[model samples]
Target: MPSVTVRNVPDEVHRAIRVRAAQHGRSIEAEMREILESAVKPQGRVKLGSLLAEVGRKAKLTDEELGTFESVRDKTPARAASFE
Candidate 1:
């Protein structure tokens, strides 16, 4: 086992951690560990080119249609990207 010390934590942040620990029925240390784990994890990225290629192959989109579809898709607002 290794010991670690975190210094100069703000009072409000410490108070929030204490509140979250109490809400979750965990010690502050355990709550902090869980928060750190989620914060530091690596996440996946979507490759739009690869995805479009796969969709084209399956759907047999003509070059003109594919271009049109891509143009339309490009104009759409992007939603949040998540990896879970």
Candidate 2:
């Protein structure tokens, strides 16, 4: 099995990870391995935020242009409810 070394972890973060490992009955190394594995695994759905970002970048959609569309949407008044 390949091994990984994470450096410069903050004291607070290390303490938090240790606490979480204890909560889950895992060693720090096992918790870290679980965390790493979870990160790289497929999430089983589209990530909308990142997909929208990529789309906007590829289509060159500017913030101002998107904002203009939001501001200029049709504001049709609602019709009164009719009872049969």
Model 2 C-alpha lDDT per residue in residues 1-84, reported as the tens digit of each score: 567788999999999999999999999999998988899878886765567667767989999966675576566865779998
Residue 24 alpha-carbon offset, candidate 2, angstroms = 0.3
**Candidate 1 to truth, TM:** 0.48
Model 1 residue runs over 4 Å out of place are 43-84
Off by over 4 Å in 2: 45-84
- Model 2 scores worst on lDDT over the 10 consecutive residues at 66-75
Query: Could you tally the backbone clashes for each prediction?
Result: 0, 0
| Model 1 Cα lDDT, one tens digit per residue, 21-75 | 9999999999999898788865565577778778897998888977877676655
Which ten residues in a row are the worst by lDDT in model 1?
69-78
Candidate 2 versus the native: TM-score?
0.50
Cα lDDT over the full model 2: 0.83
